[model samples]
Structure formats: structure tokens, C-alpha cells
Target: MLDGLTLDQMRVFVAVANSGSFRAGAGKVARVQSAVSHAIANLEAELGIALFDRSGHRPVLTPEGRALLANARDILLRVDAMRARARGLGEGVEPELSLVIDTLFPLEQVGAALTEMRAEYPSVAIRLSIEPLGGPVAGLLEQRCQLAVTVGEDFRDPRLELRALSAVPVVTVVAAGHPLARQAEGRTLAISDLADHLQIVLTDPTPLSEGRDFGVISPQTCRVNTQETKLALIRAGLGWGRLPLWEVERHLAEKQLVRLASHALGRSGLLVSESYLAHRIDAPLGPAARAFAQSLMQLSGPRSP
Candidate 1:
């Protein structure tokens, strides 16, 4: 009789229980069906417990097997986690990671990625900063962050590298009660019509977006430092401006903000903006930083139309 069970045996047992058949479990573990059946049979004999009711076409977990299932899973998970941690250490995971992202990047996506990163790398300390326009790229240039998720065209900087992430659609929105929203309630607003209202714009800290404007029709503009403030001012009927469609989808559904139909901006009415992830050439990325970059890219698929 065996006093201790191997991780392979435990894996086979769990697979058989969950898959409810020896053949299916064999497929899952990539082993022959006879190998799976033998493993389970030996495991039951060694433990002196009938783990499954084998009378049926497909084996069903016996009461003892049900009780042992949770413990077996716990052990396999811990062992797998140990292997992952060792691999991560070998891959050079940084003790601390710093990141900067554009304020225009979807908050929901960022938040979800951050949550996943924390769970995957609880030992690594992470610091995140939010900036708009040039702030993201500037962070990498100044060594303020190891990685940056930014919006705009790629700059011709020899020391920096970037990957195109996703293109976000920009929607022109205003407070439901704003004059522009009321005026363009059922009709598309022309550039001339939009030029009459104040436009809310986010100011860039770096020269990247200096003297450049996108979808700004009005000569008069209200400049803000952050996206939150821009959204607030727009919601308060202070001004109208374009924002990422993902950022304002809930607000539009709630009727807190109204989308303007414009013939000039988007293909139909939505303007698309490109975003990228950048890192400095001199700064080699550690495991943690690389993982975060992957997370950022993965979320773009679901967010993109």
C-alpha cells in the first residue's frame, strides 16, 4: 500500500472526478485511457477507499472521493503556484514596478488589469500614475515609470520603443440639458454649429500635443488638467467635448450625457484615436513589467469594436 500519493496521481483522480469518465479524463491529461483508469484504481487501493462508483457507464465520485476532492485540488494548486513562483524568480521579477498610463485609457480596463496583476504578483510592489497626452511618454523618457500606456502617434525617439495597443473611438458628448445637446437633439450638428459652443479640452504637460487640437471646433475652449475634470465639466453643462466611447457608454445610457451627431468627426459620428504602450530601450523590462504590458494588450481585444 502507498502511504503518499504523487501529484500526477492526484491530477488523474481529480480529472476523472471532474470529467466524470476515465476516457475524458485521459484526454484532458493527454494520457491513454488505460493509463488514467490504472492510476485512479491504484490511487483508490493505496488510500483503502473506494473513491468512485465504477458500476455505472461513467464513474461517479463516492462520498470519500468528494471529501478528498477539495484537498487534492488545494495541493495541486499550491504545487503549481510554487513552480510558477520559482520560474518567475528565475525570469527576474522586479521587486518594485512603476507604470504610467494616459488618462484617456479606459478606466474599467485598467482597473481589471491591475486587479489581475496584484493577484498574480502579490510580492511585487506596484505604483501607478495617471497622466494625459504627453505625460505617459514623458514618464518613460524621465525614468518615472518602467512602462507607459499612451495615446498618440509613435514618436521618433531612438531610446524608446512602443507597441500599438488599440484604437479608441471618441464620441462628442455634453450634458443632457446643455444648449448644444438640445440644439442637436434630433439632427446632426455641423462644424459651424459646434464652433459656436465652448469645447472642453485636456491640456498636455509635455510639448507632444502642444498647439495641436483634435475635434476642437469652437474658438473658445475650456482647458482642464485631467479627464475626470473634463468629464465633470461636460456633465455640468459647462462645455461639450469628445471622449472615448468606452468611458462615456454608461453615462450615455444613463442620459447624464448626450452624444452629438456630427458629419465631420467620426466615420458616422465617432472619431477613433490610437493608443500605444511604450518602454525605454535602455530599461530592460522585468517579469512584472512584461506581465502588465501583456494584460494591457489583452484587454484591448474586448474593448475594441
Candidate 2:
């Protein structure tokens, strides 16, 4: 009926819908519950449609409510993207970039990306810190790194701007001489099939599958930590596992290890995800950092020689 509702109102509406309660939404949107309720009430009055089916003990989206929820989320997300882009515009130009890359990342690809970055921003300094995944997030949050690379399910932090780098789903892998090598010739390897083999597994410093950890998989197994050790163990005919394609695809082609088969042992979409150059709300990033941020995005995908 009227376009008088504020962006804050729509944000509250979306948060309530997403969180399923005003209290939860307030926590999510970082406002008091009273403020959240007031925003939703204001939004409903301006829109001339009931945005929630409040009859339930908990808030539920009515048919009409569900319809508007989608549009409202779209609006708020675009507003966020715009805010980020507009902020980028003020960044003038960047001269140096500090990056903290995960230690498990393929060095070859990282080197290639850096080379392209160098050619494009010759004067820009590219400093890299290769650490465990936990360290990169802290580096970004603390302003130590302009960009970070991580995998697994996305975090709930609103400060970090995460971008999906790639998703090469997990595949089954075994040493060249494993008894199951021939069985993997066909598509789709099953987990139960590994019952007999000595499974050489990796214990990543942090969980690889994000919060979706199925639990400790104790195969008739040997445990390793870093990717290199696990790969070396696989080469020694230890056992089988679901591994990221980027890490093992080349080896599979080179006939070093045999990919068993696609499994339901699916990874968390096998993501090589990246986070933006971010600082807290009060701490603004400079033009040099902004330029480096753009360069990181441009250099993310598969690059040319």
C-alpha cells in the first residue's frame, strides 16, 4: 500500500523469517527483540500484507508471507553487495597485498595465481603466509591478511565476505596396487567396499568437512595429518579415502593412485573458498588493500599460462 518502510524494517522481516523467531532474528540481526518486532510491524503495515503466520507457537511464513520473504531477502542481499561495492570504489588504488593461504592448498596453482597477479600489479607487494585454515580466518579478522582461502561450510560471521572458489566433489582414492583398484574401474565406489583394505586416513588440523563432520571415521586405518603424508601413505598402498579432486586429480591421471569411485562419502562440496579483504566495521581498509582484493578475485579461477 505504501513504500514507507525502511531498509532496516525489511532486514528485520527477513531475519525473522530466516531465523524463525523474533528473538532468534534479533540475535541474528543484532538488535533487541523489541526493535525486531517493531521493524516487522512497521514492515507489515506498509506492505498491506501479513508477513508472518503468527498463529503457530513459533512464527511461520504464510503463503503470501513466503512469497514476499524471497523478494525481501533478495533486496537485502543486493543492498549488502552494493554497500560492499560502493566501499570498494572509495579504495582509490592498492600497492601491496598480504595474503594468508591455507597450507593444504596446491602450491602449483597458488604460484600461478601469484604470477598473474605480479604481471597485472607489478608494483603491488604480494606477501603470503601459509598456515592452517584456522589461522587464515584470524588473519583476515585481525587485518593481517588482505585475503584468505578456506574450505568447508560457510561461517555465520557478517564481517567476512566469502566467495565460492570452486567445488570439485570428493572422489574415492586408493594406492595403485590396492585390491580394489580393478573394482573402481566402473563408476561409483561404495564405502563398505573398503572394509578389507587398511585405510590410510588424514586428520586435518581442523575438520575438513566443516561443522558437518559425520564423526571420527576409524577405518582399519593409519592416521596422518598433512595432505602430503596421507598421499605418501596412499602411494604406499595403505587404504582408501574420499579426497578433494584438486589435490588428487593430477596424481590420478599420472597413474600414481586410482580413484576408487564416486561415493556418498561426498565432501562438503569440495570447496576451495576465499574470503574478502575485511576488517571490523570501525576499521576501514585502504585503496591499496582494495586493489589487492580485486586482484585476488580475478586471479582465483583456473589461469592461463
Candidate 3:
């Protein structure tokens, strides 16, 4: 059996659980399929227990696999902190900046700022990528990116600093034709009333895709990878799920969608996310990163006092 796993192995482990296939996971992580296969095999060996069971082409997580997921998350978080600090050393006065974010945030404000910034600093550029929660954090830690803006509290790295910018409202929604849409017009529901409901969820690790995290109250959940699908499912009256108020505003105004019910089901708790911009404390920022962070702050505007 292999010994301790490295940062690379932990990443591969996450990809497999996500993609559900070696080839697909490899493509996402930018590795060859065989390399992904080898990584998972070696990872299982190191842990002294089979993480996944070969049920066919796809692997199923054994009981042991579920236990290791948390550990892997911890290991990756530490490695990510080290990487950010290491990259800081290389960013001399001004270096290229990588900006990663959760798509659910109000991007319109930042989008305008970015356009203005490009004309102002043509020489400085930003590398941008969007993923669910862990991937963005991983990018910063892998030195693949410099800093990240994440939703939720998965970023518990002590080496970094986190800030709460705004408290966005989270509410359950469904397409107009759905059953929940009717409930919104009539009355609110109790937690136990949703036992037979199918909740449409955007299951990406990012905040925009966090409908499943409320599973304690929603036992019947369907995981969806894309925004279009979430809308489609809700429209088909197949499921109901939560979404950020920022994104749902226009739709609600247009009467395209409605809230699930007036009441909470299964002790549902709303997710109040603190937008965090994390960087290595030991490493000073390059001119580009600093300037960009400033621009981001300016674009984010101010929270109500």
C-alpha cells in the first residue's frame, strides 16, 4: 500500500467523486485518463482501504471512502495555503493575477469594473476560472491562481484572511407551473409536507450551486450540474429548490418563478454566505494582484451600515 498522499492525489480523489469516471475526471483535472486511474489506485493503497468499489465502469464509494472525504478536504486546504504563500514569493512588483469566483454573486458590478480595468492596465491581465467551492479554493492553493472569491465557509485556512462583504438572501424557488408555485400563492408549508417532493439542486461546490446543502430539510433531492437544468426541472414541476435572491429577482419580477412555500420544511436553514477573498498572509501581493483586489472591492460597493 502507498503511504501518505500528496496534494495532486487529493485533487484526483475529488475529481473522481465528481465526474464518476476516470476519463471524465482526468479531463477536468487536465490529466490523462490512465494517470487519473493510477492516482486513485495509489490513493486507495495509501489509505489501506479501497475508497471506491468497481461496480462497472464507474466506481462507488465504499463506507471508508465517505470517511476519507473529510480528511482529504483538510489535507488539501493546508496544501493550498502553502502554495499561495509560495506563489506570493514569485510575484515580484507586478505579476499576472488569477481571479476565481462563485457565479452566484452579483457579477454585473464587477463585470463593469473589469472592462474598465483592462483599458486602464492593458499590460496586466487576469486568468479567470469558475467552479464550485473546492475547485476555486484548490486553484489558489495549487498556485494555479493567486486569490479567490468564494461563497460559504469552506475556506478555513488560518494562513489567509476572510472578509464578509454582504448578506445575500437565500430562498426556495420553483418555475411558475410547478406545484410549489401554487403553494406560494396559497400558503406556506411545514417541514414534513415535503416528504414526497423532488427538489432540483445545482450541485456544484460553488455557492451558486448549493441547493443540496440543505438536504437535512430536503430528503428528496436531485443533483443538477447546470443552471439551465435547474430551471428546466423546476419548470417541468419535477422539483423545487433554493436560489440567491440576487439571481432570482428579475425572474420573480417577470412572474417566471415563485417561492416554494411560505413555510420552512424539515427545519430548513438559509445559507448566509460571507464573500471571502483569501490570500497568503506571509506573502505580499504583487502590484497586479493588489490593484485588482482594490478594483474588486470598489466594484463590490458597500454593505449597509
Q: Judged by TM-score, which candidate is best?
A: 1
Per-prediction TM-score to the true structure, in the order listed: 0.66, 0.59, 0.61
| Candidate 1 local lDDT, 14-40, one digit each (tens) | 898888899889999999999998998
Per-residue C-alpha lDDT of model 2 across residues 34-84, encoded as one tens digit per residue: 989888887888888888878879988888889987788777766776776
* Global local distance difference test of model 2: 0.65
lDDT of each: 0.82, 0.65, 0.68
**Which rank order by lDDT, best down to worst?**
1, 3, 2
- Collision pairs in model 1: 266-270
- lDDT per residue for candidate 3 within 87-125, as digits (tens), equals 766756554667766655666755665676666666777
Q: Using lDDT, give the best candidate's number.
A: 1
Q: What lDDT score is found at residue 145 in candidate 2?
A: 74
Q: Please list the residue runs of candidate 2 whose C-alpha ends up more than 4 Å from where it truly belongs after superposition.
A: 18-36, 53-60, 92-105, 118-193, 202-224, 241-305
What's the residue-level lDDT of 177 in candidate 1? 96
Model 2 Cα shift for residue 206 (angstroms): 5.9
How big is the positional error of residue 21 in model 2, measured in Å on the Cα after superposition?
A: 4.6
Error of 2 at 301 (Å): 7.5
Model 3 worst lDDT window (10 residues): 262-271
